[model samples]
Structure formats: structure tokens, C-alpha cells
Target: MSWSDRRHLLRVLVPGLLAASLSGCGFQPMLAPGSPGAALSGRVLVDAPTDRAAFDLVDRLEQRLGRAETPAYRLSYSINLREQGLGVTPEGATTRYNLDGSITYALREIGGDAIVASGRVESFTSWSATGSTLSTLGAEEDARQRLMQILADQIVTRLLAAAP
Candidate 1:
């Protein structure tokens, strides 16, 4: 076969062969219908947010695992966040900060005491503080939002994997 023709054939055949192999190995998409992830979607109730960080985390969780109309599981969580100054000016001012956060969460049946899934997820984000007061505040808030989203995604992944 011509070089161009061989390359074109390989492009099509490779993907087809990969798909065939994946199916043979019993590989399934996590969010596909009837999968463990689908079973948890829209059936988990996240605890109410008590602060800005908690609010952001809960919001992302609900976005991923749809808000439950009739909750079968209650998700309770505690958030711990710490900020440490990273970059310091020659004089005494801080120019940058690192925000470290961790969350301990548990998923339990609404009417039962047994914990179905529980774990702690930790993540960090940084922001520059060498700007105007307003700009620094904005950067800090954005970092916090990003951190919460990351933590929430980790939680959802764990919950999906733990789903029966």
C-alpha cells in the first residue's frame, strides 16, 4: 500500500481496535447510565454552608452530584483552611500567600447511623498579595474558590467510587 494510504488506514483501524479492546475488558464509563456514579447523582444531600468557603464547596458538590429532590444520603463535612505568607518584601510586608485547605466528609443514610463513605481531602492554592487592597482581596477570593472546587471534585470522585 502507498504510504499515505497506509497512514490513513492505521488512523481508522487503531481507534476501532482500541474500542474493541476496551469493551472486551468490561470497561464502562463512570457516569454512564446504571453505573455507580449515576446511582449517586441527585440522591445526596450536602450540609448547609455556614461560611463563604463552605458555601463554595457545597455549591460545586451540588453541581457535580445534582441536588437531591428526595435525599437518600446526608453528606456532612468540616472544612479547615490555613493561610501562610510565602513571599516577603525586603522591609516587612508580605507579597504572596499560600492557602492550604482540608475537608473531612462523611456520607450516611438519612435514617441510619452507619457511615457508607468517609474521607479527608486536602488541596492548596496560592495568591499574590502585592497589589492594591481591593485587588489582593479579589485574588484571595479567587484562590479560595478554586481550592473549594478542587476539594469538591475529589469528594465526588471518592463518593462515586464508594457507591454500591
Candidate 2:
């Protein structure tokens, strides 16, 4: 090939290769049905209390997941609350807000015993906004709900998929 032609090809290929390598950083669903894992359905038992709102969210997930015939694989969960604050601002606006850290958990059968598979979702919002206190609560609740779904789906997928 001519020198100019070779240079042009190198220019195109170098950028194209770099772009493809960097594209994997985006979120991806790693586990799916029919993957290299168990081929069965099982029951999930969450350990969190049945009275809390987070537990209710998990109950919704259990209903939609239907049933599994794998002799009811035990599902367990735990919830821990955490508190933290952002650094003070330079303009003298100093305050720290609250965050609701809810962790969802599940388990699956191993060689002879069940192993825990868990995920956590943290919901936080600033309460200092003017007016609409209830609105802020609504927004925080929405975030929690979405986080629950995501955690549930991830745990289920991991439980079903074979260890990679």
C-alpha cells in the first residue's frame, strides 16, 4: 500500500479500536435466563420484617416472581439504617441531610448449604427545600421503590445463574 493510504488506515483503525474498548463502562445486565446456571424456580423468603415499607416492596416482587419448583430455596434479607452529611458549603450554608439505606438480600442452594446473595439501595434527598415537604417525601419514596426493584432483579438473576 502507498504511504498515504497506510497512514489513513491506521488513523481510522486506532480511534475505532479505542472507542470499542471504552464502551463497556456503561451498565449491563450480566445475568439472564438460560445462562450457565441452574434451570429451576425456587421460593424466596426475605428476612426483613413484614411490617416495614421496604418489606412491602419486596412482597410486591415475590408476587410477580410467581413460583419456583426447586423445593423452595430460602430467601433472606436485612435492613440497616445509616446517617451521613455533606461537607459544609463555602457560602456558609452548613447542614447535613438524612439518607435511608435499605439492603435487600436473598439466598440460594450450593453444594449442600445455602449461600447469601444480597444487594443494597440507598435513598437520600435534601429536606431543606422550600415548601412541599410531602413532595420531597414522595421523591424519596420513589427512589427507594426503584432501588428495590433493581436490587430484587439483580439478586434473582445471580441466584439463578451459575458462578462465572
Candidate 3:
């Protein structure tokens, strides 16, 4: 076979081979029916938000895990955030800032006190401060929102991995 024909054949054959191997190994999507993720979906009740940051986190968690109507598990989390200057101008003015965030979460059976899964996830986002006061404030808020989303995604991934 010519080089072009061989290349085209390989492109199709490789994916078919990969799919066959994956199925033979019992590989299935995490969110597929009867999977751990499917079992946990819409079954976790996240703690109520107490502030804007908490609200963002809860919103994302709900978006990922679905809102529980009859909850089997309760997820409680605490968000800790810190801001540090990352870039400085020649005159010692802060030009960029980093928002470091961490969430400590625990999942427990709704009516029981024993913890089922617990973990802490950390992430960071940055925003530019070299702008007008209003623009700087907006950038900082955007960074905070992104940080919360990152932390929430981590929480959901961990919960899915730990689901029974």
C-alpha cells in the first residue's frame, strides 16, 4: 500500500482497536448508568451557602451533581481563601494578585454521623490589578468566581471517586 493509504488506514484502525480493547477490559464511562457517578447523582445535599463565595461553590456543585430532592448523603464544606500580590510596579504598586483557595469537605450519610468521605482541595487564580479602581474590582471578583468553580469541581470529582 502507498504511504497515504497506509496512513489513512491506520487512522481508522487505531481508534477501532482502542475501542475494542477498552470494551474488553470492562471500561465504562464514570457517569454511565449503574456507575458510581450515576448512583451519587441527585443524591447529595450540599450545605447551604453563607456568603457570595459559598454561593458560587454551591451553585457549581449543584450544576455538576444535580440538586437532591431526597438526599441520601450530606456534603459539608468550608472555604478558605487568601490573596497575595503577584506583580509589582517600579513604584511598589501591586499590579497583579493571586487568589489562593482551599476547600475542606466531608460527606456523611444524611441521618448518620459517621463520615463517608472527606478531603481538602486547593487551587489558585490570578487577576490583574493594573487598572482603574472599578476595573480592578471587577477582575478580582472574576478571579474569585473562577477559584470557587475550580474548588467545586475538585469536590465533585473526589465525591464521585469515593462514592459507594
Q: Evaluated with TM-score, which candidate comes out highest?
A: 3
Off by over 4 Å in 2: 1-42, 67-71, 83-113, 116-130
- What ordering of candidates by TM-score runs from best to worst? 3, 1, 2
Q: Per-residue lDDT tens digits of candidate 1, residues 1-164?
A: 89999999999999999999999999998878988888788899999999999999999999999999889999999999999999998998999999999999999999997899999999999999988999999999999999999999999999999996
Put the candidates in lDDT order, highest first: 1, 3, 2
Per-model TM values vs. the true structure: 0.95, 0.48, 0.96
List model 2 lDDT by residue over 1-164, tens digit each: 99999999999999988777776664333334644333334344444456555675566556545444444455667656554545457775534445555655646554335554545444443333223778656755665555556555655555555342
In order, the Cα lDDT scores of the candidates are 0.96, 0.53, 0.94
Indicate the residue-level lDDT of 143 in model 1: 100
Model 3 residue 145 CA deviation (Å) reads 0.9
Better of 2 and 3 by TM-score: 3
lDDT of 3 by residue, 10-119 (tens): 99999999999999999987778999888778989999999999999999999999999879999999999999998988999999999999999999999999999999
Better of 1 and 3 by TM-score: 3
Clash pairs, candidate 2, are 37-162, 41-68, 45-75, 47-77
Candidate 3 stretches greater than 4 Å from native: none
So what's the TM-score on candidate 3?
Answer: 0.96
